[model samples]
Target: MGRIQMLNSYIDNLTMLQSLNLIDQAVSDGKHIHHSVVNAGKIVLMQKDVQLRESVNSADIINPDGQAVIWASKLLGRPLKERVAGIDLMENLVELAHQKGYKIYCLGAKEQVVSKVIEKYKQNYSKDIIAGYRNGYFSKEEEPGIAKDIAESGAQILFVAISSPKKENFLYDNRQALKSVNFIMGVGGSFDVVSGLVKRAPEWMQNIGLEWFYRFIQEPRRMWKRYLIGNSKFIFLTFKEKFKNKP
Candidate 1:
């Protein structure tokens, strides 16, 4: 797995299947792997958020979660293999856990959303695949306890569906407390999509990299600045880096 810099963040240039295999191997070996995925918005935020940058870059595996990221990599003369979306990867990992009989701990999202995701998983797979679950609400002081609980859950894999920075920071800060968990990754809004609270973009839209537009239309007021402004900033940064690296 080659790790390259894209928009100031390191991304692993691996296909979806390759990423899954790496994670499965780590889980099988009882080794800890902190996984993360970065999209356009997250990378734009990371440019100024030093802590967020550290948390995400420190991960053992970082995949390109946005097609924009793949395009950006190409523009910078560092073409990535493919986009390994967080949601898609989570869905695959859930199936992997079921096949391998590896328990998983679900964290983040609202109580109803997380519970619904767990229910869906149990319905689609088996109840034995679930080790434990918790909503994404907690005080700063409560983080250690939550990490301790997940660590002791006998879960070989952990999926956290919280928002950025928080999820990244939480996993990085409490990594020691979560050492018992073999594979940990932040899934962003995957719980919402899995629980049927949010609809995912169609395959065509996702392929063309307009998934962000699909999300923006759903909650324009909430996502306008994130998609519109953040995307513009990302474009500028990508171009600047491209020119700076030109021979």
Candidate 2:
């Protein structure tokens, strides 16, 4: 496995297809895998969030979810093959689960969104492939129980779509309780994308790393600071690392 360090986190140097293949191998061999993803916002946050940094770096897979991350890796002397975006990974994994008869449990999004995703799977894939599902809202006290429920659901794959740090820490804290789950990943906002509540950026924009701008256009008030400030911070951090590495 190839990896490159960027600021406070390390990202797997994996293409989307390679990631899917690794996931398939993990499921087939019955190995437990805890997957994590990082973009600019996440990496910036990780610099000050010790637990976030640990949880992310400790995962079996840490994919670069933002195209900017791929560019940073390249500029800093560790060029990743490509961006393994989270939404894309989730979609591919869902299809993989369908074709392979692997059970999946989706945890996140509102009830309606998650329901739609589950229903989509039911319509397109084997009906029995959905082990169970629950929305992302829950009291902090309820986390352990939810983890237990997902563990007992007999799901081969678990996709969690809650917000950052929370989703990552939840999986990290309860990984012991989720031993029955073969592959677990925190897919932020992927449920909304899959359920058609939000449209992904067009391919050309995504290729040029303007996906954030597109998302900002969709929900400007909500996403502006995240993308604008977060992207700038990421660039600074990358250059900081780049200069630090110069001999």
Candidate 3:
């Protein structure tokens, strides 16, 4: 019998290539794919949030979406080799979708942001594989019809850029209705980055895991709370785990 893994503790880290390969397999097999990321900090925080934990753990592909996760993997001597940022994965998937002639459905970002993202994709790809796109803001009551439209559009891949638990919950709730889709990725804020609404960190900043600082500097008012508070809590929890030897 297959062993039952600990949802709270087990780190299923994957590099960019490994993640891309899984996406390829899922697309080829016509299987619904749900994916999320978990770092050392998120793992411990998720222990208390059962629904969030279950949703992430249930993902068909779970990547180490943060640098802290890559660091932890190396410390554990089972290094993931690289970080697979969600934004990069989304771009890679778009390339694959265009090459494979797969229709894509994009859902998330503000209305204008979504429009700009679609326009950018068209400009870059020029092959017309994007079946449709919708802004992130929608009444819960309208979700059923929206899902139906996407399924009928014959879109093979669906990219959900709605932030965090919302995107995760959407996938968990609508996996059945998304039957027409073979790949569904929860890509938070990737659309904004791709559409040039937000700037990405420089190579040096990203390499040293100071990307958050770069963002904080760019939009201090909006990001101060997230980076200053959320990041500090994340660091504290990571150290807590280290002292506890949870890994």
Top lDDT hit: 1
lDDT of each: 0.94, 0.91, 0.77
* Per-residue alpha-carbon lDDT of candidate 3 for residues 1-247, written as tens digits (9 for 90 to 100): 1111332644455568778888888888887777776654456557587777778777777777677667655554556667878888888989988888887899999999989999988988964788999999987788888889888888888889897677777877777898778888788888898889999999898888888789899999987976777667766655565567655
Rank by TM-score, highest first.
1, 2, 3
Superior by lDDT: candidate 1 or candidate 3: 1
Per residue, candidate 2 scores C-alpha lDDT tens digits across 26-89 of 9999999999999999999999999999989999999999889888888877898998888889
Candidate 1 error regions (>4 Å) = 245-247
C-alpha-based local distance difference test score of model 1: 0.94
Q: List the lowest-lDDT window of 10 residues for candidate 2.
A: 238-247
Q: What is the TM-score of each predicted model, taking all chains together?
A: 0.98, 0.97, 0.89
Best candidate, TM-score: 1
Task: For residues 1-247, write the lDDT of model 1, one tens digit per residue.
Answer: 8999877699999999999999999999989999999999999999999999999999999999999999999988899999999999999999999999999999999999999999999999999999999999999999999998998889999999989889999999999999899999999999999999999999999999999999999999999999999999999999898788568
Residue pairs clashing in model 3 are: none
